[model samples]
Target: MHMTAQDSRGSRASTIFIVDDDSGTQQLLADTLSYKGYATRCLSSGRLALTAAAEDPPDLILLDVMMPDMDGFEVCRLLKMDQATRFIPVVMVTSFNEKAMRLKGIAAGADDFISKPIDATEILLRTRNLLLVKQYNDFLKEHAGILEQQVRLRTEELEKVIAELRTTHQQLVQQEKMATIGQLTAGIAHEINNPIGFIASNVTSLGKYCERFLTFIKAQQTTLAACLPDPDQAERLQAMGNQLKLERIIDDVPNIIRETMEGVDRLKSIVMDLKCFSRVNDAEQSIADINQCLESTLNIAGNELKYKTIVKREYGELPPFSCHPQQLNQVFMNLLVNAAHAIDTKGEITVRSWSSNGWIHVSISDTGCGISEQHLSRIFEPFFTTKEPGRGTGLGLSISNEIVRNHGGRIEVESLVGQGSTFTVSIPMKSQGHG
Candidate 1:
């Protein structure tokens, strides 16, 4: 028996091993495989083949069915059982026409069966197909690994994007809140100043009245001390009391002064409510009282509501919330003003708030000309307005919507034409920090 091992001629080309007892058969296979651009090796016996293959495996194996010392089936069986050589594809080549012989070869672990005398074309075609299939299988395995890696990387990127979006949203909400408060400051100051002006005037007048009364009383005391020697002292005292009008002035002045002072104090409370609503002194995120914000909004918007609407509040038991209080105050103000504008005649505005499921919900409802179905959907879209020109800037609802979204919340509106409208805002309890 003779043995030969040939390295693949083509760089990066696959190799084929041919084992046969007939020199002619070996020469024929070698020429055929080599002509087809595959590197080929020809061996005269199975023993020499085993030795050569164990030394350096080929990409594929073609074993002859008939051999003297050992048949092709036994060689194939041994090769299949070996862990190092099992991955190599083996095709049995034989002149045997019996079905049992082919089955025996397959049962011995041959990857495929080819009958001889082999057609050169058939040999080439089978080799090409098997090699191509093996290459594709390897590629699929490698590609799957790369695909898994890509999936992991893409998931991480998406998570980063979601986090960034959350952070940007919160910032926008805070900015809108500050803007609304800034706009309302002038109007609120004007409202508070009116009562303060009148109260100050009333206090000044009361001071003068007290001084006049004190002077008149001193006059009466001097006259009485001088005239006590005669009955005319009684006449003089009565005359002085008449001049001072001490009876009625003393009775009514203190009550008037007290009432005026109470009015001034009430005005001060309203101003305090405005301060709370705007949250000018609070931090970005702090414990906020929603009821206080609502009250301030009502006071700041009092002039807008006084003639056209009656305001009512239906407050629920709510816990103190940590939030951007100024922003929430802006939302309240927008809804209230919108409600006030909705009414053509006397109507009602209702503000309600409560907490549930780790969230705070505030609803402002108005009995005014309600929104049309067509308009409701577009209400939150930036620059959309149903108000007459110059009456609406078209940014209020849009800005409010943006603010709510930033706070990890949502705003919804319900309205009916000629009936009224309601705007509800919901915000999460905790800030979902920056992405």
Candidate 2:
């Protein structure tokens, strides 16, 4: 009789599979292994051993040679061929003394062999050695898996840091660009303001002068009518007046001058808002009406919002607040423009401001596409944006939040995916940064 065994056991009692056609041999092997504190499964045929080993792999396999169905060599070869069972160390048992049979067992992937009239001590020693090697292989595999997971986690963290660096660099570039634009805008506004003043004054004077001229023309017409006295001369004078359309001209001149002056006033307001919105002295704190700041931001951002949205202002009276007006204006502009972009087509952006409980609240609500719950929390995180590339740098909300916090304020947002969104900014009436 001949047999083989394989092993892959850890800390648990090593399970050994005993496969042989002889009942005595099977019983002998099971008893020997069991006595050594190892678990043993006995099977009568090679097919039974293969099926049992595959279904529930043992730590070791004991295979028999010279069976009625299949021999130990064939069984060992089959076990070694399977990826799941291949690692199990196979020990072949045989009664034959032929060198050819030992070579055949070796060729079949047998790790060791036991000859019949099997020595229990020899079998135990061989089984112990094979199991030790299997345990070491398992340890190596587990270690490699842990190292792979660690590398994956570290890679993700590195990527996150790189993204933040890119965002900071982009923000610096944008700030520099804005600084240059602010300087240019301030210069242009100053130059335009002087000409606007001249035009406005001239228009006012021109309106007054035209009114006096019209009064004189009316008096002259009356004097001419009284002096002519003759009906034919009076009729001829009336015909000349009709031909000249003098009455219509007298009525239209004052209205034209009035409209011109109104245009001049509107232009002046725009320039003033532009100047206030682009003020370069951002670090200086001053007394400012928050409502006026919102109005100025709205005017400066009018073109961006007007095409797709209707802006509604609901401002309540509040005391003078201490803050950087220009920075607040910047925050409002960012929020307003973002609201407009959220809207797909026509929508309404409501700017509401009020004061209560020593805090001033300004809420900008939009009837536009609102943020999802998943993305809402990260909206103020730098470099997080839903906008397409080149359309956004994702720093608007981040910068706005920072500015508000510096003024002892906070920004809160509420949104519904399809309906709309409301962003409310609350500031302490007396800011900590102010003197």
Candidate 3:
């Protein structure tokens, strides 16, 4: 068997290995290689060389063409076949100078060839070149592994970002639908109120006529009672009283008028709320109570959430901040309605406001199905929606975001899927003064 190559102190060196059947030739090559700062090993036969390489392969191998038991061709073939030893470069060393024999060694997987009576310098040069090639190969393998790992990490990060964008898009779509509904509320209220107003007025007039007619009949009854001592008129008076039915008319007229009035009042309040929530005026900046705006918006949306959800308000003390009241009203309205709709069955929407650090913060939270982590980053993007087609237009939050930004404020959101979502809006309480 080929002995393991060692340095002067018996530690393995960065290598040059030699294999030959002739002991003298193997020793010569090993000594020459060792003198040139290369670690060297020598083996007596092809079988022994193959065995040694399988145990502890060198960086480069020099195999003799002619050997006992197995030829150099066979040894080279075996080395190339084994994955552990395949990378070691093999240079066939031979005494025969035939072209065919050299070609045979090459075909058997020898990386290079050196004809013997080998020159010391030639052996060293060939070994040095082969070692450089091996070093370069190792570097490439390591670099490839690192590149693959980086690509995998980057891909994961990108996937997470994409998921967040999708979610944000969905939220913005819902907000847009709410905003559109807010804009149309005023017209809708006006259309319903006109008919309600006249109907209530007519009911009031009819009630008064009924009361007068009943009073006239009661006066006739008092006259009949005064003349009751005369039995002749008693039967005629009773027949007249029963035909008029004055008591029944008096009892039923008031209830009809009251019910009509109540319906009209309810319709009128809805119209007032619609006007407050619509923000139809075009003003750049105005001072207004944000809490009042929230209340109006909730009132306008009452019909929307009446059967679907409940709204809870936790309004804190807020200093009046300079803002476009109309635009801000739109923002609050969109957020409130969106929160209500997020619930699939029954849910609660919470609106809270507070002031701190020279800013006013409004938080709208929902107890419905919440947003997922992947979609949180994209909630304000234009045309994003989680709602079905015809139910959403996806531009509400995007527009709200733009309006808030114009007023020097920012909107942020936090959500957990299957739990709930919260949106926080922060706006500067006072505009920056010009120098």
Candidate 4:
């Protein structure tokens, strides 16, 4: 029961457990530690100390070496084995000065050993130093937990930002590509329109000239037959006419001119469709017919669709809606092309449009292989594609979705794995501020 040093240093009142069989020794240690601003609990047996420590672990344990039921070494070993109490420092109190005794205490996981007739200075110093180390360790663990949480949060935020940036980049690239294509097509349409116009006009004139010449030749032959009554002269004129196949020329010339004129008219229609599909005023807003946009897109994408699928139009009466024509054309184009590609061999792509409840709906349905449930949700996600490499960039639907959204519209899709897919685009009739 040695109590000599004054450890009245810290403001914090830390709890310490003092275990000893001797009542005098327990009271002496508790009083000394309590005076030093440590809340002390006195347990008279090793079993009582372990039970108390498990219920409410103290910062440190002062275990006596020589006890009845269990000694300090066994008590220390038990405390160290418990997960909750293992980190608590154990200072063994004994009168033994043998080196083997210290080694046994150390093997039992004791932090330090105090000899009998303990110096108060030594006990206080060792206790204060162990408590400080424990406090520092706890602080570090708390700081590490906070740091890990912060890192997790920051990583999530960065991932979200990176995803957004990738989407934006894909959109920008698509927009630039569409813009260049529009400009090039518009220029080509302008260049070709001039020649087509003149060719069409010239063919029309040529047809009329052929009709006049045929009429004049027939009238001259009839006049010659009536005026020259000699059989030899009339027979010679008939022989010349039969040799030249005059009747065949008169019948075939009109048919040939008509077919040529029809071909020229077809060329003009294609050029007009090209111009409409790639209009130079892409950013301009107008009250446009959605059906007309679909028709123009169909004509422009005919070569892509013709080889694989047949297009069926089921257009209902739709009111003119205010929107960007070129953008809508692009949306229809993407849907049509995708529909064509969905077909493995031959299939039908049905395009339907109708207006109801103040909304204009255009649906492109394919009889081709449909999307799977697993992939349907991610079809509009940027860079998500099921097409083979180099066959697609996977941004078509995503960009089209954005374009439709800007025009106060949405796209809905329905599909079965083996059946087919239908994509419906709905736009408000009174959409505002879309370019």
Candidate 5:
């Protein structure tokens, strides 16, 4: 159906050029387009068409595949190659309905291909769509030039998008960390529970010990008052001590205090590790023990791995390297959590590290669902994920890649589709900005 006259009023009238050596076909196409209220020009030769196009370009060209001097492909190529008429949409017109001819036409810059003995309705639809596309492209070009004048506005828009993306990515990372923290709730409580529980028990026992000593003191005082020379209070005290097993209580009280102190120390260590993991020291690069970073990160991810896999650590002795410890901890946490998720019910995760040639190498390998070859290449691409919907935000590896690159590091991956995958990160021992 033709668009309303109102649609055509403000918009420029589109011109169609029918280029075909077949006089009958050309006339028919011209009449069909003319009936659609489109202006039409017919040319029987590619040479004439080229000349006319350069003189006055048409909005869309219907090109015949078989011509006398030049074929449709060559004519289309020459038309597209020219600067003046290249934007005009070329529709390949031919009776040859074959895949090869269609591909050839496409290769030669034909915007569309329509088989010959063209249906009036089909021609109208195809031509109309092509005209619309050309007009839209022209409109874009015009507005794009206007946009070039408003660079600051466009830049502000871009920055806003970038900021939003960064915020979203951070939220995703924090969400994963929070999930890990939830898993750690039980383990950390268990760690703290032991010490506090024992300390409470010890306090109760210490209170009973004090009461027994008080009773013995009262008995000694009564003896002192009753008679001659305090009536062997020392002997009575010794007998009372043996009866109450005071020696054992004295020895055990010291031991309980020591154990409680050790437990308190352990609790302090865990709290300190958690603090270090979350420290704002990430704002500056500093010398850090990579092994310690990994160990602390492993602790954070312990709950994720404990039930799912057996973790083996073949950590080489590491020299302190300049890095943002908190950021590296983030990287390690992401890797560890990913490894844990890769497993179905149970599997093995191996974390290995070493230093070579002034570089530190750390690897996390998992026997889980390995990435398919098709997806492996895009693993570090933002928003590309193989994980099921609502399962993960694909930004983990992407963020890891950014962090590694910022630290002057590179990551290498090896994976088999069903067997396993290994991601190795190698960073400079002395990263840039290290003083």
Candidate 6:
């Protein structure tokens, strides 16, 4: 029975190896597979076929089950055991159609079977279908590998983006610190200038007083040298002393020195307070009195509030708590500044502190333009601001919130429009402090 199978694409894109003891069967498979656009190689024995397959694997194998010397079943097992040739499809050709023979062939790794009176159509169909399945499997594996590579690349890119974002956030925090320092520098410069200016003026006055005293001493020496003093000499000496105001100079020098010393002390206190507030690098926590810190911050920020707000303190008794003193000072400064800004004109800002239930609560209340409920919820969000542009950076409350939370604490607020707002900062007696 001579039949020609259709070559689907009319190209030898697939190779089929035929192993048979029968020359007729080998020639038939060759012609049939070649006509179906499959390239074919023929071997008379299973040994030749096994050797050829190991040297160069084929896409499919058609083996006669009852071959001499080495049977097709043995050949199939050998091919299946080899890693390189195992994926190739194998079809068994045998006259025996018994169920036992079929099971035996299947166990030997045969993909399909054809009878002795082989139907050309059956052979072509089985081979074509198996080739299609193998092709599809290969394609899927290739696609999966590409997908895995792409996933790896995307993960790396995401990690890089996260790193950049973290760096930018840190930079913003540092910029805010510098901006706060800038504001403090302006106020402190003015504050320090006041006492220094007056002290310089007092030094000038003291210099004039010293010169006048020297003149009085020289006149007194001249009068002493002439023991038989004339009335006119005595009168001249009294006049000179009166003109010099010697008695008044002697009395005022001590008072002037005292006042100058007081001014110097004031300058020192201001400097010390500023140093405490700006201990940015001293991130270590220590036992500190929040009340004392609040008072010092109040004094440091006094220049900003003095003109527009009257700050009143209602301090309550409190024990020292563990905290980063410098950071808390910054929070106090920010709160006071915000309170002052809320007031358009003169107003009262009262700061109160107390210790209760293993925590310390510090409250800053202002009688000014209060925050609306709509904006209050977003107040702690970074870069959120209600103040006019250029007047605020909107980082104060956000930073304060982070600091408080880090210190094992929290902040609360109460407000009424056009009435006032109160910000209460609460901290545990002992913090999980950071360095």
- The predictions' CA RMSDs to the true structure, in order, are 18.2, 8.6, 9.8, 9.1, 16.6, 18.9
lDDT of 6 by residue, 115-221 (tens): 87878899988987877766665567678999999999999999999999999998697658655864675477567767777776776677577668767877666
- Candidate 4 residues lying further than 4 Å off, grouped into runs, are 1-12, 19-27, 42-56, 65-86, 117-121, 148-166, 192-277, 280-368, 371-435
What residue pairs clash in candidate 3, if any at all? 163-374, 164-374, 167-375, 168-378, 168-379, 169-384, 173-394, 176-396
The models' CA-based lDDT, in order, is: 0.78, 0.84, 0.78, 0.85, 0.80, 0.81
Among all windows of 10 consecutive residues in model 2, the one with the lowest summed lDDT is 1-10
Ranking by TM-score: 2, 4, 3, 6, 1, 5
lDDT of 1 by residue, 54-137 (tens): 899888889998899999999999998887777778899988878999889889998887889789888877877677665665
TM-score per candidate, in order?
Answer: 0.36, 0.61, 0.47, 0.55, 0.36, 0.39
| Per-residue alpha-carbon lDDT of candidate 4 for residues 1-435, written as tens digits (9 for 90 to 100) | 122222223344678999999999888888777888788989999999999999999888999999999999999999999999998989999889899999999999999888778688888898888887777666677899999999999999999999999999987987786667657767987999999899889988999998899889889988988899697999988898899998898899989988888878767765655565455234678789888999999999999999888899999999887888888898899899899999999999999999889999999999989999899978976557899865665767866886787788899999987789999999988775465
lDDT over C-alpha atoms for residue 379 of model 6: 88
Give the per-residue lDDT digits (tens) of candidate 2, residues 286-319: 8999999999999999999989999999999878
C-alpha lDDT of candidate 1 relative to the true structure:
0.78
Question: Can you tell me which runs of candidate 5 are displaced by over 4 Å?
Answer: 1-282, 433-435
Regions of candidate 3 where Cα sits further than 4 Å from its true position: 1-122, 125-250, 280-320, 324-359, 364-423, 428-435
Q: Between 1 and 6, whose lDDT is larger?
A: 6
User: Model 1, 194: alpha-carbon shift in Å?
Assistant: 32
- Using TM-score as the measure, the top candidate is 2
Off by over 4 Å in 1: 1-283, 433-435
